[model samples]
Target: MATPTPTTDAPFGLDPSGRPLSDKSKVAAGLLGIFLGGLGIGRFYTGHTKIGVLQLVVSVVTLGLGGLWGFIDGIVRLAGSAPTDAQGRVLR
Candidate 1:
């Protein structure tokens, strides 16, 4: 018997770079950005403390306009224009 070697052409279900995003923070961030993005809760959940804090401040300062910003940011992230997670890991 021989051990099966992993191949690069597995499928889209995994990351080609082999650094697949298994981090709960990233998933949570993505979800939050998608749903609660208006409040920047996603940013905070993903470890982007600076951005999260800024979002909170902006949302408060702008009387919830920051939520729009957060929503846009979430779109960009989900679209792959911005791939860094809260820990800055490029999602695959």
Candidate 2:
């Protein structure tokens, strides 16, 4: 018997560069941002601590209006255009 070789495909769990995908879920992050964006929940879930902290500060300072950034980010993520995670891996 021969061992089947693993294919390096995005849907197969490998990134374009043939690396393992991030453990984070795009939908989960999106939902978190849409609902608790003001709290930077999505950014935190995506492992972007700096962005999460900044988002929190901005949302707090702007009286929550700044949360629009996070909300839009969520939409973008859902649209399949989110950036890489803090560890430079694309979210799975």
Candidate 3:
């Protein structure tokens, strides 16, 4: 039987920080973005407080039009092309 390679030994992969993978779930974040994007809840879930606040502010300032931005972001995340977590690690 072949032995499985260790995470450190995995080829062609690594977080930008050269650290272990994040435990965050893109699905969860995506859902939040889709349902509560105007509130920036998804960004907060991913540890991006600043972005979250910005989203919230935009949502308010634009009278909810900015919510489209968050909605799009949520779709992208669900598509598996999401950005890294605050720790610079890809979501699981």
Top-lDDT structure, candidate number: 3
State residue 80's C-alpha deviation in candidate 1, in Å. Answer: 0.9
Per-residue lDDT tens digits for candidate 2, residues 15-91, read 55556567788789888888888888999998999999999999999998999989988888888754566776677
User: Per-residue lDDT for 1-92 in model 3, tens only?
Assistant: 44433375433345544544556888999999999999999999999999999999999999999998789889888997546789777786
**What TM-score would you give candidate 1 relative to the actual structure?**
0.65
How far does residue 18 in candidate 2 sit from its true spot (Å)? 2.5
- Rate residue 48 of model 3 by lDDT: 93
- The TM-score leader among the candidates is 2
What local distance difference test score does each model get?
A: 0.64, 0.79, 0.81
Kindly report the root-mean-square deviation of model 1 from the true structure over all alpha carbons.
6.0
Winner on lDDT between 1 and 2 is: 2
TM-score of model 2 vs. true structure: 0.78
Better of 1 and 3 by lDDT: 3
Off by over 4 Å in 3: 1-19
Per-model tally of clashing residue pairs? 0, 0, 0
- Worst lDDT window (10 residues) for model 2? 3-12
